[model samples]
Target: MEGMALNQLFGNAYFGRKVLVTGHTGFKGSWLCLWLTSLGAHVTGLALAPNTEPAHWSLLGLDEVHDLRVDLRDGQAMRQALQEVQPELVFHLAAQPLVRRSYRESLLTFDTNVLGLVHLLEAIRETPSVHAVVNATTDKVYAEQVIKNGYPEDHPLGGHDPYSTSKACAELVSDCYRKSFFFDGGPRTATARAGNVIGGGDWSEDRLVPDLVRAASTGSILQLRNPAAIRPWQHVLEPLSGYLRLGQALLAGEPVEGAWNFGPASDATLPVHALVSQIQAQWPGLRSEYLPGPHPHEAGVLQLNCAKAARELAWRPVWSAEDTIRHTIDWYRAYYASSRLLSSEDLQDYVAAAHNAGLEWAA
Candidate 1:
């Protein structure tokens, strides 16, 4: 998928569109920015400066993006940025995204994840240029039921940790704004709940793939707190495709304003140890050591049923667990061996895979 074919994705809804992306400095946000720009969307990124050294946003060197370093918690700043951008499409991905860090900085997590979203939505309510909005949440928004079949879109929203609870609150905030303000003829709003997203360029703290990369690059033994924890994992592009498809639906005046899950197939769900083993198989130097200790409360098992996305959006993950691990390891291997970026290549490969799978968006 390239050139005309790439632009044809999502019915070419993104082409020539003015798009606003919050948290564009973060991992997933950077990837979304790259993909949106590739589809010919004029992107304006609104978020704080990149917090980490060697940030993906800087590495991508996307000079065309109108980058604005504005804090989401600042309502005035959010309003000013939205007013200036007057974006036709919006993707909100900013938040305190870590569970353990949330326990340490619970107040900051709530203020950023919950209140930050309020600021964005309030701004969107006032700025009429925005025709569609997708608020990216997490799979942990569902209460811990440990269900084998996986949590559906209607699963009761609850969270044991601050990060999860705050995202759940964000989901509620989106719903409130949608009904209270945008119910009649306003920006079509929806929420996206994605599972554990692993790919290149995600060097965020406390995440599994990044931690493994750190240990492997430094030749240190990786620590595993909950090796048996099961999570529905997929490449970063999987849920992003779902989000883009959902946005396409909204932009086309289709009725897709609601919560949707973007996760891998049931067979791809695996334990932390299993994922670690797969990564180790790909990179022989990677090693791990299980640690026995009292750790922060994290979900032991979580899965998502993406039937709604499949039925309505015609979205399904194109990569399997093996493909995900292999591509992830290959990416880090290329980056560490030489200063190289595989993001664009990976995106093209993913689009091609989706095209091969007969996905409508790729078609």
Candidate 2:
């Protein structure tokens, strides 16, 4: 069940279809571009330059496709790009996506995460060929609650930090667009909310898995910001799989509404220390210590209840927390070792594993 073929679930729907992926130079978008290319989709990417070296886009050789370096904030350029591509399916993933960074650059964060989405939606409205859209948002969009239960899609949308708040605003923008313009006989638009995604090829600053991988490679003493913080963690592939499924439904003229959550199973929400230790065990003699420091307000405990996605889209996570960590470790280890293996190779192997795991969506 873990070795399912990628095409089995999507079929020939993507073949020859013009697809536009914003933020294609980033981690998640790069992976999606690769998968779309493999599905025989005509893929075009729009993004600012990659901030980090050895990014996933470069790793997968995404430049061979239609890669355009563009900022999401420039609405005119974005609109022009959309008209040029004439995409049938659009996946919106561009944003300023870090919490601490958002604290320092509050205006930039809001402009990118909130207004950038507005620009994208406006472009989609002007482009008539685009029939389906999935705007990738974060689980942090939910306001902090006193309870430990996972947050459902209908939960009060709020955020303590700028990054989360901007995403919540983005959700509101999408909802307004859906109701105001796309209410009937227009493009099907939806937002996907996912939590603390971990995977290979992610070198973003202040992220957990990437920090751990870097420390393990360099034998550096890794400093922990908040070891007790708990989050709903899932493999990157898990939510990307959900996005594809949602796109399929929208393309088929299914009337989906508002936002959806695709999070890890109930028990996969673990403390930061536990997840760090799990990956640490894979690297012998790796030293790490928790150093309590003053940090901005981040959620101590966050989770998502994906019952809507389960019931409506029939989508659920395929990898357990432990398996996610293991696969992440394997990819980074092979990556640092430069053992004559490409990340694209690792991706193919992961898809096979997901198929074998009996993930119906992957099938």
Candidate 3:
């Protein structure tokens, strides 16, 4: 079942609220900041400079908010920045979020994904104004078990690759902090493990949708490392809605803390080739070739059981896999053809569509 309206669910919880978003320059972070700003939240963003020249941060005009450029690995600097912001709600989304790149840059991946959380948690512990936190983690944190059913929230956490291992470690850190300190008087903390998310404005390299669209534009063959690998895919807003709902519950003093899975319905889990082929259908000329090459280890099949989120937060994915791919391809096609990036209008349109689809968050 769908959840309640955003206004009813939030009840002005975000209006005039002090919110801090780490990694605000990244893809999902930019979208979150935009949404929070629309809700009349006083948003402060802390992140490194955008990695890509044509990054979503600039495209979305995120500079309109309180944007600060800082390294999360620098504990003192992060602490100082958090102190200055003194936020009531914190959404931590900063991490080295690529699998192939993690193999080459293992040290940096661990440092940023794992140690970075440590720094942020330390800062949160000292920041008095923080009432709740939502830590964005990946579904890859689970141990790669060859199973068709989705991994539940209590699934044993394990990871083979550096990226996954570091995220698992981050989860452990959050658990420790939640039990040791936050349980008493510290800010409520929770970990959100979402599946592979695809949407507009995600220009990250080594990702499927971006790479496919880029290759199609140049008429180059789209070479996939694991074309047959299955993944739970959803539009970016799906899990983001879960995070916001979780945060709202926390602020309302509801017992909605700890680890949670915000994934798509089981039907959205599809192979990489299928995803590429679907996008090609929408755009009409995306040629792809599966080239067998040396690649780092990745889970052949991954899925998440979002029963907890649906039962507790009343959150469910609004878009189907086909709709998600279509939305993504259409955005990239328009952007490449006219350089018209996503704006508040597009955001409003998305929410309206979600509302039409009976999504509670959009209501």
Candidate 4:
């Protein structure tokens, strides 16, 4: 989509608006910053420096973004950053995102995911310029269950590990702040629970796609744990679209201050082994070996019902699971083989596809 056409998206809420995206140095956060800037939004990013060497944030070279290396645990610093930027819209994505790492750094995960959100909300409360906030949680927030369909928004919030538990706690924190503080005269807020997001530029440790990329690039056998585990998988752009749509509603003063699920269709929820096979089909010569026990606890099967987003927000996933995997693998291949960045190309293709699908936000 062109600049004017992209600006017309989400009812022009983002065009020329001052937006704050926490965790802008991370994989998903960098994508969000790129999209927001494409829509002509003035973006201020607040988060710690990128931990990875080939960090996507640095690769993008988004000079327009006001990148501030502020740790979310510091309440005073967060408050000061908010006061300085005075963004009208906020998307909170900063957190200790790894599940396995959370086991070793339980306290750090809790501090960053739970208390970090508290600090941001407190800062939002103090900063009067903010109007709408989208707190990005994860699908693991739902308690373990044996339901066949999928977990809805009303499912009980619970977690088995520190990372999941911290996010669930963050959900609760968002609720407490939304109801307790963001009332009659306060900024509107909502929580977004999305499925397992896979895309290029996500070189995070212990994740499936990055692991596959590393193994494939190094000509090593990929180790697999919980091969039967299933998750609601979608491209990174899928949930970012949902977040932007939700932000559009909140900015429009719509009554959408509650939790919502942004996930793929039911059939897209595939097991770990099956997803691996699909990716191997796209890229030949990818070998793997299943690792036995001694692995940390992870959800076996998890899915999400996005009926609420479709019915109310008129939002839906533009690409199918096959499309998502293909785009993701192609991106990594281009990056490694020829040092080409397909992020901008992927964004344009995704927007065109969404517009073709008649999604409300894209239209």
lDDT string, candidate 1, 1-363, tens digits: 776567778888899999999999999999999999899899999888988877889999999999999998999999999999999999999888999999999999999999999999989988989899999999999988977678999989999999999999999999999999999999999999999999998888899999999999999999999999999989999999999999999999998999999999666799999999989989888889999989999999999988899898889999999989888889888988997999999999999999999999998
Q: In model 3, where do residues sit more than 4 Å from their true spots?
A: 1-9, 343-346
Per-residue lDDT value at 55 in model 4: 86
> Which model, 1 or 2, shows the larger lDDT?
1
Which lDDT value does model 2 have at 59?
71
lDDT of 2 at 286: 70
The 0-to-1 C-alpha lDDT of every candidate, in the order given, reads: 0.92, 0.84, 0.85, 0.93
Best by lDDT: 4
Kindly list the per-residue Cα lDDT of model 2 for residues 255-333, writing each as its tens digit: 6757999898665799999888888787776778988878788999898888889888878887788778877788888
For residues 1-363, what per-residue lDDT tens digits would candidate 4 score against the true structure? 765678788888899999999999999999999999999999999999998879889999999999999999999999999999999999999999999999999999999999999999999999999999999999999999967779989999999999999999999999999889999788999999999999989899999999999998899999998889999899999999999999999988888999999998666799999999999999888999999988889888899989999999999998998999999999999999998999999999999999999998888
What is model 3's C-alpha RMSD? Answer: 2.6
Tell me the TM-score of each prediction against the true structure: 0.99, 0.95, 0.95, 0.99
What is the full ranking by lDDT, best candidate first? 4, 1, 3, 2
lDDT of candidate 3 over 61-143, digit per residue (tens): 75558999989899999899988999999999999999989999999999999899999999999999999999999999998
Error of 4 at 173 (Å): 0.7
RMSD of 4: 0.8
List where candidate 2 sits over 4 angstroms from the true fold. 1-5, 339-342
